[model samples]
Target: MPCRGAAACSALAPTLPSARTVAAGGQPMQLPADPIEAARTWARHDPDPETRAELEALIARGAREELAERMAGTLRFGTAGLRGVVGAGSNRMNRAVVIRASCGLADWLIERGLAQRGPLVIGRDARLSSEALCRDAIAVFAAKGLEVRHVPEPCPTPAVAFAARACGAVAAVVVTASHNPPEYNGYKVYGPDHVQIVPPVDAEIAARIAAAPFADEVPRVDDPLAHPRVRPLEGLRERYLAALDGCLAPRPERPGLRVVYTAMHGVGAAYALAALERAGLGAIEPVREQIEPDGRFPTVRFPNPEEPEALALAHALAERTGADLVIANDPDADRLAVSVPGRTGGFEPLTGNQIGALLGDHLLEHASCDRPFVVRSIVSSPLLDRVAAAHGARSVATLTGFKWIWHAALELEGRGEGTFVFGYEEAIGFSVWSQVRDKDGISAAAVLAQLAERERRAGGSLRARLERLYRAHGVWVSVQHSVWRPGLEGRREIEQAMAQLAERRPETLGGAAVERVIDYREGAQARPSYLGRAELVELQLGESGRALVRPSGTEPKLKIYVDLCAPADGEIARIEREQRERARAVALELARFVGLEG
Candidate 1:
């Protein structure tokens, strides 16, 4: 089953024990060994009534399968930290899990002699159970005899990371689920460097968590916020806002453009509006319906800006206002989504790649420092590479996620390789400045607003600028396809698929010859620190096209990323259409090769 470990299996529910039941391919369903006993033990010690009752109900109903699933081992901590549904059981993210994670982190720091270094910073987002989780963590850290600082209020993820670095804290914890569904929440940890924890640190903390005392056994203090070691995060918001302001340029004149922005019911609107206005891009109209921080995210099915449906409200608002541009940020505001008015009236949201290219080009063009460089995920559009090169800058590719991108950027700066200017991932994450060594949607939105204003003043549009970029560079188009692979069996299927692909690497994809294959599983390439031991495969194709396959780190899905370049000289529209078709074709082939159904 691509065995992560016995503990993970214990936290994960296995197949049904029914005599007639079989696996996906008519194979015998192998049940987890004594998972019910483990589940009972976990339930007995669970501190949360909701989750405890959940386990009790499953036990009362004699739901062996459900109980086993709940008892299956604890969720493993990785680069993204702890993320799961909020419910009972060790596999879930609950008060007990949060307590253990926090205590374990405390133990790790203390063991490293970092407990006396500085206060640890903690922040929460507007999500159900987020505050509770944050409180649980604070109590644990306080009880561990370490100082702690809490954000003055619920803020974006980047703010917490920024606070960790700005405050010189030994570490930080952010209670959020990022763009996950409302039913899900997560715990993200950052090291002293303010970047997400990676490698031995994550492993050490995970081991400590696994070995921690039961929830009730862990000492808890009441009103940890009032404790002397607990300090208020005064002026953190202002500091973050000021950092974002640094990304701005003196606008010759306010473009007086109509812009509609939506926070997707996130904690970003307040910060986003302030940053945009401070950048002198003129005031922007807010999508009032989705303005506030509503953890329920009632307006959209998904809180991610990359989803077209998530931006539906913003698009409608933009059209009604005849807005010149549209901007939307995901729940935590670590990612941004921008849209320009389409020819047909509705606003057309720009793909993360397009936005990355535009932002990279603009920032590189205006860069005043020498040895300027931009960073992008290996799977992201290579168009940024061309853009950076054209502007006499270098483009560095890192493994996916801001943890890797930011670390790479800092390493380059430390080594005097170049000055870190911009960094982005295809999944709507961007880091416009180094102030917050992570994705800062607030600043990214501000930068884009400036771009739109400049383009408008030049008698052009962002889309026109994009077309010019295309005409200058080749038409770099890309598409992503996903196959839902849930549970342990699903994980096994993904592993088998990747192994099969490695065994028989495709000779061609979408009529393009496969030139080479890069298997990240083997660590064949120099990767970011946080991407240690991740299973991924990439195929380098002719014409600057690439096909990458990997299981989503945070979601139960197999993702296939495809990128292709086509001639952009003739009809830009025609080239775009043709290249998009080619990208889709390549994605389809990769999906098929990975045994995913269309």
Candidate 2:
């Protein structure tokens, strides 16, 4: 059942020059998957020769393993759809997986009985595999007697979700890895309502995809460069922009905010700028180096806005231009982060938690809703709890993905259960409205711009608003400790950590004692409500809140989310000191416990 020898491996190996083998028991274990052949199989009928060659070379010399590793799994279709490295494996998001997933989605549409009245819309990002994945999806959907409307050019993923509802399609698919390395790509599914598919729907779709027969079993066409869908959705951008216009409330103050925008080599610039103007914030500038869509992602190592390094150019440009704010969107533009000047004349990147807290406060105070329910994920800060309580509104915590928030929102809207107001994840994702089921950076950018304008006119800055939230809610300071594991051994090493931590739970970290421990692995709450749950330990130090650990569903990283709520009179210095100490303690303990090399 296991690979025995390199000599035996070479027999069916795609004649690559070298093999990447690792030692097992004693023999060099060959990769169970062939990436070169996977790439070849993907590219044999590819329309673009350059793209095909690029994939071929990348896959040839053990590309199969890389692809298999990336595609070998299902790209993880949880509350959030697939987000991972793009390669030849089923685990990764290769064209084959996209085809399989799309076919399965088609079956779902047929079964749902929405196939005749509605079609499927396809959208994508600037990732290398995005275009191919989109094409693969289109072909599959078209063959299933469903109309497909493809976005003509690279665009933000939310637009596809938005267009699904606008075009009367039953569902939508966006091919984007979204904030992962350039080597990664992914697929996120949306229902006709333009929100993510939740619970039984996701399970049903995955099942249909798995049950799908061979690729050839479906319709096969030798044609390339042909439109598989009924036609490209040419006016998708305009429709989204127009709809965004209606979402904004009246401007609070000056029409110009002098903002610096960056798309992070993804497809968010045009729409984001439109949003700024729509919010009556004019003269917004974009960081040229990162605005345009570039698959190579030449500027940053990873296209995540959460990373300070990725926002370096934007921050620099903001300072030089003396802009009011700097906004950076992740590759797919589903998430947005901002940087504002601190006391020392330099910009500080606001953590996703900080931004979400600010937005939560603003929406709760200003939104014209009928008792809206605020939603956030487990990994996000509980600061929303404070804000929601102040408004007499109910708040719900779902698993750490927008899918959970989307489902909660849909449930409320469906039964007129409750008004869905604002939802956000700590990782730069926010759903300000239910217009789009998935997070929309463009829409949120507009909303944020409006909020900033209103606040500036009200005698405060976004920074001030955050500080106010800090003062009112006792500044819930949070930090993340992530342990990155590279290969299979690395993966095993990381997974082994759960057992280790469970066995040896820390009583104290940097002098902060654990008040309570929530073992989500035991399904501790006993409530039948929570979905996609995991082990969550509530480490309440002498301070506010502390989270022990959880495994990243999308990545091979062991995550420790730490939070400390400081007092109102607490100086920024005190908060920073504790954050540093707590972060150090967690990292020290994790590193010492995990026993990985420095």
Candidate 3:
């Protein structure tokens, strides 16, 4: 039967055909029996005219294969929430998908009896489709009889996170893709604890989303913001700034720190600048071309600050302005990147581990807590543990992801193990303050600025401070190697590689002996309960170094992290260079051992 309209299609459940079909060369294939029918149903119910037309065009062109791919499966909701290219299908990030996701989230909240606890906060970035999708989410929440609060403009993600915590909301959702490419958009859900939803909860939400009603069938309020259940999330930015004020300890202002900052065409300019000024950090030179919240990201090939090309303009500005420090925030402004003027003149970007070590040392040095503790992800450099121990503080390592990092910190603090001072991941994500459980690049930038200024006031530079710390704790050099394998075959290859490594552990890597192997999948009684199970393998090389192999949670790639250390008995630069080479060699060996040498 042909679907006539939106109401008619709501009753249709487009399920994958169970029967297999023959393909070219008599190969077996499992594809939808009638993808056109599925497309027609989806098109009828798609609220957005753009997406509806998109599906219609595909159907008109008899693009059966393409349609099947688009309808292969719904987007998977993991710990990171939903992220994908914006388009017109169940597998894409679109209005219909957002509506269904919102409805499911509403169902989960109601089932958990959290819907009436507080308002559900919604926020979005400057992505092209973010505003519309955010509205769709708001409408669904309002229609579900839940109180909705939303940020009025494009703002840093940390601002939304802080708003969720300060407002005592039951849950929050941010419509953003963070540092993902321009074509991507995402939905990030935060539990009442002000952190990303973790396991059991993530699984629960996924089940609800899978059982959600069709987009058109879900009740939605037109002009949701005007509804009595919805209200503007006011004073969010101001409150965020006020929280930043608490991140800094009282210290003399160093009015001479010249810094060049870039938002990478993100929404961080206003918030970062306000935080800097509030801290009495001298005027920061903003990259004019990339300061605004332009989703197109017209200035860079990639919006991620960790990418060298993304920070090229900032480096240029820093050189031209003779700035002492260069700081950048990824789009959505949840992660931070920094560079400092090298002894050789040009600005040298600091690795995430370097920054983490420096910031960990700085925070511990001035910590007010009698038992300050820091946390780092398993993939992050282990130097933080040394830094923590040097300061007589405890250091905890959790499974990869800021969600795990923050949750571990909270659990430890609750048990009176220590006061949570800071936590960071190897991906440039940092949480300088505990109030906002997730990473806050805006606050981190301010704290980094303070660290830079303090170093300058002491007649030293960040580089010099880093060297001093290295001298105290052996020099640690960390490097990351990634092997990209896209599509189903690639995913299988990644899984095979991990399985092989776990089965046949390498005796040595880069000529260094592998003393022990820790497979995270096999939970350890010695490990904290919150560490959880993850598909990660760690090869400990005694005092020389260590290597970690794991598949990326978000992208289709296998990642290997190598960390090597050397005594700072000689030239620090030479030791760092040599250790870095050793680390890269170890990473390459690990990749080759897993048959992922590409």
Put down candidate 1 lDDT per residue, 225-343, tens digits, no spaces. Answer: 89888888988878888755556787556457678989889899888888888777655899999999989989888899888888888888888877899998898998999999886
Off by over 4 Å in 3: 1-40, 60-65, 251-254, 524-526
Ordered from best to worst TM-score, the candidate numbers read 1, 3, 2
Worst 10 residues of 1 by lDDT: 1-10
Report the number of the highest-lDDT candidate. 3
Error of 2 at 108 (Å): 2.8
TM-score of 2: 0.85
C-alpha lDDT score of every prediction, in listed order: 0.80, 0.71, 0.83
- Total backbone collisions, model 3: 0
Please identify model 1 stretches exceeding 4 Å from their true place: 1-33, 523-533
Clashes (N, CA, C under 3 Å) per candidate: 6, 22, 0
Clash tally for model 2? 22
lDDT of 2 at 400: 65
Residue 122 displacement (Å), model 2: 0.9
Worst 10 residues of 2 by lDDT: 5-14
For residue 388, give model 1's deviation from the true position in Å. 1.1
